[model samples]
Target: MLCVGLDPDQQKFPLSLQGQANAIFTFCRYIVDATADLVCAFKPQIAYFASARAEDQLEKLISYIHRHYPHIPVILDAKRGDIGSTASQYAIEAFERYQADAVTVNPYMGFDSMEPYLSYAGKGVIVLCRTSNPGGSDIQFLPTTDGSGEVMSVYERVAKSAATKWNTNGQMCLVVGATFPEEIAKVREIVGDMPLLIPGIGAQGGDVQATVKAGRNKNLMINSSRAILYASQGEDFAEAARKEALKTRDAINRAR
Candidate 1:
C-alpha cells in the first residue's frame, strides 16, 4: 500500500548531499535502498528532476531501482497530457527511455492522449481523476452527463469511462487524492476493483486510517512525498526515511 514518492528538493536535503554531483540520484538512491522493503512502489515526480536539470540522474535512478529492486515497480509521475505524435513521444520517454513500469497521465486531453500509452502491452497508464489540490474541485466536482445520459460528477465520469471504455488493455488506473475519502469511495463504487494511485498523504494532512478505509478493497498506491523524503535534514536522512516509511506502511496495513 505504501508508495514513497521521490520528490527530491535540494533546499530540503541534508547538508551532506546539497552540492554533490548527481545529488538527485544520490538522494533518491538513499531513500530507495532504505525503504525498498517497506513500499509497494516508488513514484518519481519528473518535474523535480527536470527543474534541476537532472534528467540524466532521473534515468540513472530508475535504472538502479530496476537492477537492485526488481520486484518493485517504478511509476514515473510525469503527468504528461498530449495528443497524437506528441503523446506517442511522451510514451517513448516514459517506457522506452526510463523503462518505468507505469506512468501518470493527464486525462484532460481525452482518450486520444491515453491511447498511445495503452498501446504498450504491460505498462500502466494512470489518469488524473480527483487530484489532491483544492482547486481540482473547481472542475472535478462539476456535474456532467455520462454517455448513457446518466448525471455524474466529472471525476465519476472519468472513473466510469476508464473502467468500462478506455481500459481495453486492463492496465488503466485512476489518481484519486486521499484527502477526499468520500470521492475515493465514489470512485471505487464506479470502478469496482480497478487499482488506484492515491496521493495527498503525510505533509498534505491526509489521514492514513480514513484513506485505507475508503480504498482498501482494491489495490492502492498510497503515496507520501515531502514527509518521508525530508524526515530528517541530517546525515541520517535515509535511516529516518526508512523509519518514516515503516511507520506509514504499518499504519496502512493496520487500517486494512
Candidate 2:
C-alpha cells in the first residue's frame, strides 16, 4: 500500500488558504480525490489538524474521509505509545473514536505499553523501530550487550523482537525509514515478511530507487508526505499533488 502523510502545517500551507478551515478541508479533499486511486491508504497526521483546532475536529475530518472514501484505508499517524493505562485510552481514542485502520506507535515504552493496541484483531500497530530522521541514529544505533554477550544495535533488537515475538497476532508492523537503505535492509531481514511503513522520501532526500530495492516486501508500504501534499502552493495544488503521488506510486510498484 502506498501511504501519503497529509500533514498541513500553517507555515507550509498555501498563502491563499491563510486562516480558513474550509481551505484545509478543500486542500485535503482534492488531494484525496486525486490520489486515492494511486494509493491504498491515506495517513493524516493528527498534529496538523490539532494545531488548528481540538482533537474532536480532527477526528471529524478522519470520519469524513472514511465516510466518503470507504475504499481507502485510513492510518492515523499519532505515534501514540505510553505507559500503564494511558496506552489503553490511546487505543480507544485511535480505534474506537477515530476508527483508524492503522496507527504508528513508539516501542521505546516497551511491550506492555503496546499491548493494549496490539490486542486488536483487525487493526494495525506500526511500531517505530528506526525513524526517518538524522537524529534517529543517536538511540536506534546504540549498542547493547545481549544475554549471549554479543553486542547489537537497539533497532536491530527491536526488529528481531517485532518479527519473532511482539507481533503474535500478525497485526504488528515496523516503521523503517526510506532515508537509510542499508539500515532498511538489515531491518527487513530481521523482520522477515512483516509489513514496513517507510517514510521520508521526497523532502528528506531519500532515494526512492534504493529504498524500494532494499525494503520492498510483500507487505511494505512506501510513504511520501510533503512531496505529494505540497506539490504546489497555488489553486491547482491538488492536481499537482496527484501527479506527484502517481509518479511515486508507480516508482514504488516497479521497484517492488
Candidate 3:
C-alpha cells in the first residue's frame, strides 16, 4: 500500500501558501484531495506541526482527513517512547486526541514502553526497527547475543521480540527502511507476515524495485514524502504530487 507522508515545511511550500497561517494544513489538504484514492494511509509527521507550533492545525487536519477520507488510515508519525505514565499519555495523544488509526513509536526502552499503545486493542502500534536515516546503523546494526547464545543484529532482535513477545494484540508493525532492502528481507523472514512500514523510497534515494522484492507482503506500506509532497512549487503542485504518487504506486505494483 502507498503511504503518503504529509510532512510540510513552510520554506518548501508553494509560493502562494508560504506566508499563510494555515499553509501546512492547506498544502496537505490539497495533496490529500489529489492522492487520497491512490493511498492506503496518510502519515503526518508530528514534527512538522510541532516545528510550526501549529498543533491545533494538525488536529484540524487529522479531523478533516477522518471526515472526508475515513476509509484511508492515518498513521501519526510521532515516534514517541517513554516510561509508563508518560507513554500512556503519548498513546492518548496519538490514538485518542488526534484519532489516528496507527502511530509510529520508538522501542528502545523495551516492551514496557510500548505496552500502553499495544493495549489500545484496535489501533496499530508500529515500532522502529531498521530506520531510513543514515545514522540508524550506529545503533540498530550493533551485534548482540540472544539468550540462546546466537549472535544477531540489534534490529533482528527487535524484530523477533516484537513479533513473538509484544504482538499479543496482533496490531504490531516494524519500520524497516526501503534503503536497506537486504535488512528488510531479513526482517520479513523473522517477522513472517506482520505489516512493515517501509520509508526512504522517495527523496531518500531508496530503490523501489529492491524494496518491493525484499519487503513485499500482504501488509507492506511503502511511503514517499518530499519526492511526492514537493513534486512542484507552483499552481499545479497538487497535480504534480498526484502524478508522483501514481508513479510510485505503479512502480511498487510493477515490482511486486
Q: Alpha carbon lDDT of residue 216, candidate 3?
A: 56
User: Model 2, 1-256: lDDT tens per residue?
Assistant: 5888888766666767777656667667777888878887888898887777756656766787888888887888999889959999999988998899988899998999999998777999999999999999999999989789988899999998898888989999889898899999999888878888989898887877898778755677888899998888777788899999988988887777
What shift in Å separates residue 219 of candidate 2 from its native position after superposition?
1.2
Q: Give every collision pair in model 1.
A: none
Model 3 superposed RMSD (Cα): 0.8
Q: After superposition, how far is residue 240 of candidate 2 from its true place, in Å?
A: 0.5
Tell me the TM-score of model 2: 0.95
TM-score, cand. 1 vs. native: 0.98
Residues 9-125 of candidate 1: C-alpha lDDT, one tens digit per residue: 999888888799998899999999999999999999999999999999999999999999999999999999998689999999999999999999998889998999999999999
Q: Pick the candidate with the highest TM-score.
A: 3
Instruction: Evaluate model 2: give its lDDT.
Output: 0.84
What residue runs in model 3 are displaced by over 4 Å at the alpha carbon?
A: none
What overall lDDT goes with each candidate model? 0.93, 0.84, 0.93
Comparing 1 and 3 on TM-score, the stronger one:
3
After superposition on all CA atoms, what RMSD does each candidate show versus the true structure?
1.1, 1.5, 0.8
Tell me which of candidates 2 and 3 scores higher on lDDT.
Answer: 3
Model 1's alpha-carbon lDDT is 0.93
- Candidate 1 residue-wise lDDT at 116: 95
Clashing residue pairs found in predicted model 3: none
Descending-lDDT candidate ranking? 3, 1, 2
